[model samples]
Target: MKARRQRLILEIIRQQVIETQEELAEALRAAGFPVTQATVSRDIRELGLVKVPGEGNIFRYAAPGETPPLRRDERLKRLLRSSVQFMDFSENLVVVKTLPGEAQGVASAIDQASWPEVIGTVAGDDTILVIVKPKKLVTTVLQRLNELARG
Candidate 1:
């Protein structure tokens, strides 16, 4: 039952811009799950749901690693433009320098972009280490990052 309800929650968020726990609980009830607020909260946490920017100033819940592709790209572009001070690469490793307290957010945006070339990223207070596979692709990744930073 829990699994089924959580699945429904994922589906609901995908289909609609759910903005609050109360809204989620209502949707669950509409779907016949009859959940309490606490249950809804726990399910959100267990599902690793995140709030991504929505239209205008609104934000809505999204499943882990599931920000829509266009929005994800826009977010990455925005982050790179605003927070990144410089980027450099060597071999298969790309280092991104961001303003203090911005590295983690910038890295998260990069990870969320889901670029095939990126293997993983590690972030500190003002730097991100982005690892790319197939050292030959480092240039391609760097080019893409530069474009995003410029935009």
Candidate 2:
């Protein structure tokens, strides 16, 4: 039951912008899942859904890792071009500097990218610490980021 409902949740979110738990629950009920708000919330957490800015001031849920690859790449490239001031690396880490208050947005974009080379990221007000998977891949990731920033 949980698996089927979770699958429906993914399907619904992919089909339209679901902005709230109530909205999701309603969608599930309409789909015949008849889920409660608490159950929907738990499913959201378990599915690792993250809220991304949607139209207007609203936010919509997204399964970060499941975003279409081409769209994800384009979004990441656009994000880097717009917000990344400069980037540098040492060993297995890459530090990205962004305009003030922009690091978090850029970092979130990177996280949503699900890049194999990236372990994770930590963002401050204007700085982001990116942990690369393999130490040798730091240069590769840096180069890719630079290319993305350039284009």
Candidate 3:
């Protein structure tokens, strides 16, 4: 039932501009789902819906793009460009800051990049500890992070 409702939520969002949980709940009710605002809210989170900019400066819920494996790199690059707040390094550890709740995604992107200098990454709520192969390569890793953040 949860999966079906989530699928319906996705369909409704794709078909129209759903800007709020109330609006989404109304749509779901109209579709015979008998939903509450809280249920709709949880469904939205479970669906990985994001409110992105739409026409006339409004934001509307849409599905995330993780379904397409081919766009993972492009998604990573875009996430890095938008969420990377600051980067610095000491010895073989490069530290990166991101907006709250974005560190994990940024760290995952860094790990997916498979850069020769990166040994691994540990992410927190808003910070990432990136392990480098050698202390000497810290500068190189930092430079690469800077470039990703810039573009």
Candidate 4:
């Protein structure tokens, strides 16, 4: 039921520059979902939806990837939470350690992150090799991954 609602809300936003919970609710209603503002609010949160600045101080409920960075952040958080056991960096590479059989999934997510520093990834049973650029950024990358592990 929740998935269906989420899909419909996503579709509604895809059709127009949705501006408010009320507008979204009305849209969903017209499309036959019979929803309320509160439900739409919850759906928005669950879907990781956010408002992006539109023309003249207005904001729109943008689906991820209609904008920059937001979707990557969402996917990275989800992936880090699920699969990364540990991560470290050396020179121009990051080594992500995962639970046995999980490295490939996490590696895939990191590749999808589209982080400018990340060049590519290679995965084994419990490890990922993240090729990075600008070797000077190694410590920064390590610290970031450690933070991800901690949280």
Candidate 5:
């Protein structure tokens, strides 16, 4: 029931600008989920939601923004930087090691960067295995990741 309500609330927020818990509560009720304000509050926290620009003093929630971390670009600047301990590539796979717990965020930043060489990335606690297209892209991928770490 909780997951159902939360999904409905998230869908509502994603589709429209939802302000206050009161508004969310009403939306939930409309969606046939009897939800309390406290439930909505907890859901917001659990979802890692943030309020972005909206109408008037009413704040709207959204999944955390993907606009790269502050003070740098998405790849080397945002995620790698000092946190990246090592990086290397073999064939079409690039391995990146970060200071534990940072790999996921760094990898997420890379995924959000929308690079052409990147087919996709698999991230662990402090490591990421980035898969590139056409094995030859290894050098280019490594160079791009290295540039990102520059920040």
Candidate 6:
């Protein structure tokens, strides 16, 4: 029952914006789950749901690790353009330098972009190490990053 409720919650959020626990509980009840606010809150925490910027000033719940491609691309471009100070690559690794305290945010944007060639990233303070798969693809990834940074 818990699993099914959680699944429904995920489905509900994916279908429409859910901005508050009360809204989620109401939706659950409408779906026949009959959940309490506490239950909804617990389910939110257990599901690791995050609140993301919605239309204008509103924010709505979204599943962790789930980002629409267009939004992700725009976010990555904005972060790269504003924060990235330098970028270079060697072999299968691309090094990105950002303003102080910006590396993790930049790395997260890169990760969210979900580029096929990128294996992963490690960030520290003002630097990010982006690991690419296939040595030949490193330059391609670097070029893409440069383009994003330029935007």
**Comparing 4 and 6 by TM-score, which wins?**
6
Instruction: Give the distance in Å from residue 135's predicted Cα in candidate 5 to where it truly belongs.
Output: 1.2
Off by over 4 Å in 5: 1-76
Candidate 3's error at 14, in angstroms?
36
Q: Per-residue lDDT for 43-73 in model 3, tens only?
A: 8888779887665568788799623222444
Per-residue lDDT of 89 in model 3: 87
Prediction 1 global C-alpha lDDT? 0.91
C-alpha lDDT of residue 129 in model 1: 95
Q: For residues 34-140, write the lDDT of model 5, one tens digit per residue.
A: 87888888998888778765544455776787232222352347457768999988888999999988988887777776777788889989889999988887998
- List runs of model 2 lying over 4 Å from the truth: 1-66
Candidate 5 vs 6: which has more lDDT: 6
Worst 10 residues of 1 by lDDT: 64-73
Please, what is the TM-score per model? 0.58, 0.56, 0.52, 0.54, 0.51, 0.58
Clash pairs of candidate 3? none
Q: Is candidate 1 or candidate 2 better by lDDT?
A: 1
Q: Model 6: residues >4 Å from true position, as ranges?
A: 1-66
For candidate 2, the 10 contiguous residues with the lowest summed lDDT are 64-73
Judging by TM-score, tell me the better candidate of 1 and 2: 1
Q: For candidate 1, lDDT tens digit of each residue in 69-98?
A: 658888898999999999999989999999
Off by over 4 Å in 4: 1-60, 63-68
Point out the worst 10-residue segment of candidate 5 by lDDT.
66-75
lDDT computed for candidate 6: 0.91
RMSD values for the candidates in order, in angstroms, are 6.9, 8.2, 11.1, 11.2, 9.1, 6.3
Q: What is each predicted model's overall lDDT from 0 to 1?
A: 0.91, 0.88, 0.83, 0.78, 0.76, 0.91
Give me candidate 5's TM-score against the actual structure. 0.51
